[model samples]
Target: MKKKVQILSILFLGISQVAFSQIKEEKLILDRKREPEVKKIEKKKTSVTAEKNYPPKEKKTQDSLNLKYNITDVPAASDFKTSTIQGEDISPKFNADYQNNYFQLGMGNFGKILADGNISTTLENQIEVGADLHFLSTNGLKKEYNWDSSQSSANIGAYLNAFGEKGKFNINADFGLNDYNYYGIYALTPAADIDLQQKTNRFKVNGYYDFYSNNILNDVRLKSSILTDKFDAKEAQAELLVNLSKHGVEIPMDEVTMNADLGINLETINSEFSLLNDNTSNYFNATLSPKLTFFKGKSYLMVGSGFSFLNGKNNSNLLTEEAKNNKTYWFPKAEVQIAAADEFKFYGGVDGGLKLNSYANLLEENPYLVSDQELRPTETKYKFYFGIRGDVDQSIKYDVSAGFAKMNDILFFKANSLFNNDFSLNRSPYNFANTFSAAYDNGTVSEVKGSIQYFPLANLVLDGELSFAKYNLDNNENIYNKPLVVASLGGKYSLLGKKLNLGAKAIFSTDKTTNSFSFTEAGTTPNVYLETEDKNDKIGGFADLNLSAEYKVHKNFSIFALGNNLLNTNYQTFKGYKVLGAQFLGGVKISF
Candidate 1:
C-alpha cells in the first residue's frame, strides 16, 4: 500500500507541472497580443476632400452677342525650322549591396585569434532587435627575455528599438571581459615570478527616448555602467539627461528657439591595495544649461551658460586625511555660425565644462595602472576657438580650427619608482615598476588642427589630418607622455566593378617625455635619508602603416587580408612598453 501511494503522488505532481507550463505560455501570448495600438507602425496617407453645392442653379438661356472673325496664313512644312534635342546625361549605377547579419573569423601570428558576429531582425509594430558578439585573443609575442604577455578580450551586446508615430525608444546593453598581463620592463627577472596577470569585467546599459512633438520635453537619455577587476577594484556610474526645447518663439527675434538641458550623474569607486588597504570614493554632480538660438538666413547665433554643482567624499589611508568637498561652477556656452558663401562657412565658439575621471577610463588609456589613485574631476575654465569649414568643389572638403584653454586638475600618467640607490625594491607588486600612477596639475593648453578629405573618383576617398599642441604648466615643466604633434593619412579605393576594395592608413606621433626618479642615501644608518633626483626619458617617435584588401567571392561571401605595423619598428608607445612587430591576418566573412 505504501508503494502505491508514492506512485500516485509522483503522477499528480507531473500532471500539475505540465498544466502550469501551458497556462504560463498562454498568458505570454495574450500579453503580446495586448500591445498598445499607439506603438504600432502607422503610415497615414493624406487625402483631399471636394466641396459640393447643396442646390444646383437653373440653366438660363441668356442674350446672344454678335461675333467677329479674322484669317491667318499657315506656313508650309518645308519652310518651318527644326532643331535637334539634347538627351539628359545619366551615369551608370554601381554595385551597392548591404546585409544585416554577418560573421567573421581570423587568425594570425603570435597566436592571435579573432571572431565577430552580428544578427538583427525586425518584428511586428516595427520593433527592431539585434545582438553582437566579438572576441580576440593572442599568446605572448616573441620577447628578448621571457615574460608572459598573453591577453584575451571579449564582448557581447544586444539592442532593442521601438518606433512609434509620436516617439522612438531604444535600449542596449553590453558585457565585456578582458584578461591581460602587466608586461613592462623590470629591473630583475625574478620579479616575473610574481603574478602580473589581471582581469577586468564591465557591463553597461543605455536607453534613450526621442519625441517628435513640439513640447518642452523633447528627449530623454539614461546611461549606467559597472566595472570590476581581479584585484577587488570596482567602479559604477549612472547618468540621466533630459532636453527641453520650445521652437517658433518670438522673443527679441522672429523664429527663435529656446532650449534647456538638465543632467545628473552619480559614481562610486572602491579599490583594494596590498599596501594602501581599502579605499572608497563617492561622487555626485548635477548640471543645468539654458540657451537661445536665433536664425536669420544661413546665419545663426547661440548664447547660453551652464551651472554645475559637485559633491564628493573619500576615505583612503594612502592620503594624509579623508577628503570631503563641495563646489559650484559656471561656464560659458556660446557659438556663432555665419555663411560666407554657398560653399563656405565661418564658426566660432567659447565653451567649457567639468569632466569626471574614473578608474575604468584610466585603465583603457593605459592598461597597467596602480589602483591607489587619487580620483578627481578636471575643470576647464574656458576655451575660445574659431575656424572655417568649406568645400572647394564636389570632390574636396576641408576644416581648420585653433583653440586655447586654461584647465585645472588635468591628469597625466607617470611611471612609479623602481628601486633605491642600493638597487633595493621599493614596494610589493608595483616594485616591478610596470604600473603607472595618475598625477594632476594645472596648466594652459593651445592646439591647432586641420583635416581634409578628397574624393577624386566616385569609388576613391583620401583623408589626412595633422595637429600640434603646446602646454604651459604652473607646476610641472612638461606633461608626462603627451605628444606635441600627431598626424594620420588614409585612403580607400574600390575596383573590379566594386567587388574589390583596398585601404591603407599611416599614423605618426612625435616623441613624448616621461619623468623618472632615482633615490640616493644621504645620511648614515638610522638617519639614512633618500634624496630624489628626477630624470627625463624620451620615448622615441614611431610611424605605423596598415593595409587591407577584400574581394567578394560571392554575393554573400568575401575573403580579406590585413597587414599591421608593416614597418616593424617595434617602437615603445610608453617608456618601458614595447609594441608588437609586423603581423598579418587572413580571414573570410559571410553576410546574409
Candidate 2:
C-alpha cells in the first residue's frame, strides 16, 4: 500500500510540473508578443517629448508651389459707348497718299502780303532734307502814323541716321535767316527820318550716339550753334551731354538714371558808332543730375546741381560805372513726382539758373532797344513751384500751379530819355524815333497759372488758360510793361466729316502802367520828366478776337481764311507801338 500511494503522489507531482511548464511556456510566448507593442508605446512617448521641444517643418502649399500669370486683352472700339461725352481722337490723322511739299499764299488789308513754302524729302541711307521759306509784310492803317513792317525768314535742315551692330548715330544740321523791321515805333515820332531794319542768321549742328550696352554709359549728345544779328552781335554755343543708366545694378527701387551736361557759350558785339564799343562774353556751365524711381516708377525724385562761370567785358558809354566782369553761381535743381491716384499726379520742383542776357536775345524780344545799352546776365536765385495735374474724366484734363521766383537784374522796358540825345553829335542816342531802353530791377515775382482742356465730342475741343502775377520790386518803382492778368479762350470744331474746320480765339489783358517821359525845352538842352497825365493815354488795355476757318476742297488742296483783331481796338503793346486793327487774310494751300 505504501508503494501504491507513493506512485500516485509522484504522478500527481509530475502532472503539476507538466502544467507549470506549460503555463511558463505560454507566459513566455505572450511576453514575446507584447514586446513590440511595449517598445512602440515607449517610442511614441519619446517622439511626443521631442515634438514638444522643437517644431516640425511646414509642408509647402499647392498654391505656393505653382506660378501665376496675368493676361489682358484689348477691348474693341465697338465695345465703347458713343456719345457727346466720349473722348476725342487726339491722335494725328494723316492722308497716306498726300504729297509732302506744300505752298501757301495770301493777301490781307493794310497792304499785307503773305507767302509760305515748304518741301521735305527722304533719301537713301536714311537721310532726310527739308527747307521752308516765309514772307510777310503789312503797310500801316489809314492813320497819320506811317507804320510799315515786313518779315522774311528761311530755314533749311538735314538729318542722317546711321545704325550698326554697336549702336545708332544721328546727325543733324540746320540753317536759318530772319529779317524784320521795327516799324511800330513810328508812332512816337512820325516825322523823324529813321531806318528800322534788323536781321538774324543762325546755324546749328548736332550729333547723338546711343550705345547698345548694359553698362552705365549709354548715350552721348553733342550740339553747337552760331547766331548773329544785324547789329554785329554774334553768339556761339556748344553743349555736350552724357547719359548713364544703372539698369543692370540690382536695387530695391525701380530705376536710376543720371545725366551730365557741359556747355560753353561765347558772345561778341561790335559797333562802328562811337556811342557803342566792342565787347565779349564767355560762359561755362556744368551740371549733374540723378533720378531715382520707386514703387515701380509710380514715384520719382530728381536731384541736381549746376555750376556756372561767366567772364565778360562790358564796354558801353551809357554806363557811368563798369559792370561786373566775372561772376560765379551755384544753382540747385530738384523735382518730385508722386502718383496719388491712377489718373492724378502731384508734382513740385525748385530750379534756378543764370540767364545770359545777350544783345541778340534782347533785340529779338524788343527790336527798338537802344544800341548803346549795356548787356548783363540775369541771375535767378531760385524758383519754387508746385502743382497738380490730372484727368478729371475720360475727356477732360486740368493743370493748376503756383510759382515764386527771386531774380536779380530783371530787365524791363523804359522809354528812352531825350536828355542824352544830341542830333548833331550822333544820330539821336535812341534806337529809333520810338525807342526803348532796357532797365533792370531786382525783385521777387509770384504767379498763379491754370489751364484746362475738354473734349466734349470726338471732333471738338475746348481749352482755356488764365494767369495772374504780382511783382515785389526791391526799389519803390512800379513794375513796368508787365501784364498783371492774362487770359485766353479758344475752341475748335470739325464739321462735314472733318472736311471743314473752324476755330476761334479770344485774348484779354489787364491794363499796365508805365512811366512815360516827355522832353521840356530848357536852356541849351532838353530836360526829361515823367508824364503823369499822359501815362494812360497810349497804354490802355485791349481785348482781341480772332477767327480761322479751313475748308478742304480736295485731298491735296485746302482754302483757309483768318481774321485778326476783329474788334478794331487800337491798343499799344509798347509805350508808343500800336498793333494792327481789323484785318483779314485768305489763302490756298497746295500739297504736292
Candidate 3:
C-alpha cells in the first residue's frame, strides 16, 4: 500500500507539471527579463549635486556621490488570497481590502487540501486546531431595540490540503475539520430575548486526485463534509468529479471545443433527539452537474440536478438540541446554473440546496459582522433564479430572477434551553420562510452597490422581525424566527485604488401590537414590555456601517485599519440588546 501510494503521488505530481508547464516556461522567460532589468539598473549611475564645505579651509564645491540601492522584483502570489488560520471563524482574516492579494499556502478545505491558503503544512497534520477571541460590550443601560452580544470565544480543529504534483499527474487535496463552543445573548429589549449557545465540530475533505497520462485526467478523488455535535447533529457529504477534457484545460481562441466532467455528490445528515435522544433523522442528497461550452468565445453553461431522500422520527430527546428539535425537510431537489461569457463576464445559475444552521446563525450574529459557522439544518428548498454575472462592466451586473419555494421545518434560536427542553416530539409548524432579493452594482470603483429587500408577512414572529431577521416570538408556536424585514438595504464601495473598502447595511420595519401604554393603573411610568396598538415603531433591522482600508507602504509591509458601527447609531437591531457604540481597530501586516 505504501509503495502504491508513493507511486500514485509521484504520478500526480508529474501530471501537474505538464498541465501548468506553461507557467514554468513563463517564469523562466520572466527570469531572463528580470536579469536584464537588474543589469540595466546596475549600469545606471546616480547623479549628485556639488556641495561646499568638504574642507573648512578650502570652502570649494565638491561632487558628493550617493549609493544607489537595487530594487529586486518579486513575483506576485500565485492566487487571490491572503490569510490562513485555525478555522473559518478564527481571525486575523485577510485585510478587508480586496485588492491586497498575496497567497499564503496552507491546507484545509476549498481549493487545496486546506480551504485557507498558507504554506505551513507541518502544523496541519492531524487534529486541526483553531482559535477565535473577540471582546465586545456596551453601557449598562439595557434599552429596547438595542442590539448587543457580549464577549465570546470560538475556534476549530482539523485542517489539511496539498496540491502540485504526483509524478506526471495533478493531484489536489483539500480538507478541514472544525469544532467550536459559541454563546451569545442579544436582547430586543422589553419583549424579545435571544440567547444562543452551540457546540459543533465539522470536517470536510475534498479534492480531485488526478493522474495525467497522455493528457488524460483520471483518478478517484472525493470531497465531503463530516460533522459531529454535542447533541445529535451529524452530516456528511461526498462528491466525485472526473474531468474528461483533453489536455490544455482548453485552448484560447478555439471556441468550438468542449471539455466535459461527470460529477456526483452524495450528502447525508442524521439526528437523534426523541424521548431518549430517540428522534432519529436521516437525509441523502445527490447531485450531478456538468459543464458545456459552445463557440470559441468566453461563455459556458453548467447544468445539474440534485435529489434527496429524508426521514425522521422525533422523540423527547430531540428537544435537547434546538436543531434536532425540529424534524422537517424533503430529500431531493432540482439544480440549474450557467456561467457563460467568461470567468469574469456573464454567468447565471440556481440550485435548491442545503445550508447548515450554524453557518446561517453566524450571519445573524450582528448585521455588520461576518461569521464562518455553517452547521444549521440541511437547507432544503426548490430554488431557481438566474441573472448575468461578471466583473465586466466593472460591476457584478445580473438580470432579475424570481422563483417559487417549498420549505420544510427550518431552525432558528428562540429563548429555550435545548439542554432542558422537551423537543423530541414538538416543533412549531414547518418553519415558514419566503425570500426575494435584488440589487444594483455601480460600474464605477469607489462607488456603491445598493440593494433593498423586504418580507411581506410571516406566520409567527413574536413582535415581528427587526433588521436581518432578529425575530420576536409571541408564543411557543412563535418558536420559529423570521427575517426581520424580510427586506433590507446594503451596498459596498471600493476606495483609494481598491486599497480601502467600505460597506453599509440596514434593514427596518414597524408594526403596531397589543403592546400599549398599560400603566400601573396610573399610566405614570412606561413598562419595559408595554405595548400600544396602532402605535407603530420600527420592529427590526440595523443600519450597520463598517469601513476598512489597507495600504501597501512597502514591498513587504502594509497598514490596515477597521472601523465598525461607524455612525454609532443608537438604534438596535436586536430587541433590548444595546450594541457597542463604536469600535476602532488598526493593525499592520508584513508578508511578501
Candidate 4:
C-alpha cells in the first residue's frame, strides 16, 4: 500500500506543476495585448481636451470701425423764381433753374404758381399740354400827358419726360422747350426814344447730382453740375461741404458747431457786346465757419465769419487770359432768433457784405485779355437790418422789419459819345448806341416788407402784405431818385372736400417808381446799358387783380386754372418794362 501511494503522489505533483505553468502563460499573453492597446488610446487625444486640461477659458474683446455708402435723386428745377403779371401767349413753362422761356407774347408768374399751387409740369421732367393767354386794354392814363399802349398776344407749349434711375450711380436729367412774346412797346418807346420788343425761345437741361450723404452722416459730400443760359452764358460749378461731426461725438443742442465749404464757379459769356466786355467771372468761395442755431422748440441763432475771394476776367475765352480783378473780402456775421414763447418772439439778423470791387486785376499780366482800364468800377455797402415776429394762432402770424443801407461805387453806365441815333430798333453796335461805364453814382436805399396772416375758420385763410422802398443817388446832382410802394391782400378757400382750392388776390404798386426803372440805364438815361439807367423815366401807379383754382383728381394727378390782371386794369410794376395784360393758364400735372 505504501509503494502504491508514493507513486500516485509523485504523478499528482507533476500534474499540479503543469497546471500552474499554463495559468502563468495565459496571464503573460493577456498583459502583452492590453498594454499596447491602452498605450495607443492614451497617445491619440484631441486638441480640445489638451487645451481644457491646461487652463480655464479667458475672455477676449476688441474695438472696431466700419464704413458705409448712400445715394439719392434730385434735379436743379426745385427752387423759387421771379414773379409775373400776365401773359400774351399760351405755353407751359418750366422752373427758372432749368430753362427760362420768357414770353414775347407774354407769360405771367409761372414760377410763383409752380411753388404755391399744384403744377408738376413746371418741373423739367414732366409731360404736359397747356395754354396761357392774355389780353389787356388799359384805359388811357387819367393824366393829360399820358403813356398809352395796347397789347394782343398768345402762346402754346407742351412737354414730355422719360424716367430712369442713375444706374448704380445717382444721376438725373431734364429737357424741354418754352416760347413767349411781348407787345405794346410802341408806347414803351416814344419818338424821343428807341422802341424795343422781345421774343424768347428757351431750351433747357440739367443733369447729375453725382454724390451725396445720408441725413445722419455729416461727413463728406461732393457735387458737380453744368448750367447754360442761351440769352446769358454757360456755367460749370462744383461744391463740397464737409461736416466735422464724424471726428467726434456729444453734439450739444443749439450749441455752436464748426464746418467747411468749398465752391468753384466758372462761366463763359455769349458775347463781349452784351456786357462791359466782362460778364463772365470765375469765383472761388471757401469758408470755415462755426454755426450756432436750432429751429427746435421755435428758437434759433446762427453766427459765423470767414474770408472770401473773387477773381474776374475781361474775357473768358482765352486760356492764358488773365483776370482784371482779384478781389479778397473778409467779414463776420451774426443771425439770431427767439420763438420759444409760443405766440410772441423777435427774430432778426445782419450780414456785412464788405468787399472791394476793384482790388487788383487778376489778368493784369496777361496780354491776351481784352480789358478797358477807364471803366473805373468800385463798390462797398453796409447792410443793417432788424425784425420782429409773433404767431397769433396755428395758422396766423405777423412780422415787421426795418432796414437801411448806403452803397459806394455803385455800378451804372455813362452815355458815351458813341450813341447819337441810339434807337430800340437797332440790334448790334449801330442803333445800340452805347458806351458802358461800370461805375455809377453812389446811392442810399431804405426798404420795408411785412405781412400778416389770419385763419378765421379751418377752411378759410386771409393774408395781407405791405412793402416800401426808396433809392437816391449820393452824387453832386442828386437829380436821379426813385421811390416804390406796394400793398396786397388776398384769401383762399377750401372746397369739394378739400380736394379743390380757390383763391382771389388784389395788389397795388407805384408804376412810375417800380416798373419805370427796372430797365438798364445808359448815359444817365433809362434802359440802355447795364449798370446804367433807361431814358425819360417818370413815377406812376397801377393796380392788379388775380384769381386761381386747383383741383386734385387722384393721388398723383391734378389740374389747375389761374387768371391774373383779372380786372383788366391798366398797371405797371416796373417803370420801363412793359407790364403783361390780362392772362389765363390751365393745365394738368402727373407726378410720381
Per-candidate clashes, comma-separated: 0, 0, 97, 47
Q: Write the per-residue lDDT of candidate 3 for residues 57-129, one digit (tens) a residue.
A: 2111110010111111211111111111111121123232232223222221112121122222224322122
Model 4 TM-score relative to the real fold: 0.52
Candidate 4's residue-wise lDDT over 26-95, tens digit each? 3212232111111001110111111122221211000001110000111111111111332222222221
Ranking by TM-score: 1, 2, 4, 3
Error of 4 at 318 (Å): 17
The TM-scores of all predictions, comma-separated, are 0.78, 0.71, 0.45, 0.52
Residue 96 lDDT in candidate 2: 17
Candidate 3 is scored at a TM of 0.45
The candidate 2 region of ten consecutive residues with least summed lDDT is 79-88
Regions of model 1 farther than 4 Å from truth: 1-98, 191-194, 248-277, 419-429, 517-534
Model 4 gets an lDDT of 0.38
Question: Worst 10-residue stretch by lDDT in candidate 1?
Answer: 61-70
Highest lDDT against the true fold, candidate: 1
What is the alpha-carbon lDDT for the whole of candidate 3? 0.31
Best by TM-score: 1
lDDT by residue (tens digit), candidate 2, 481-574: 7788987665555556667766655666787767665433345545422222234333666666666677789978888877676666666777
Each model's lDDT: 0.63, 0.55, 0.31, 0.38
Q: Which stretches of candidate 2 lie over 4 Å from their true place?
A: 1-99, 142-144, 147-180, 184-194, 203-231, 247-250, 253-280, 290-297, 317-327, 422-433, 523-538
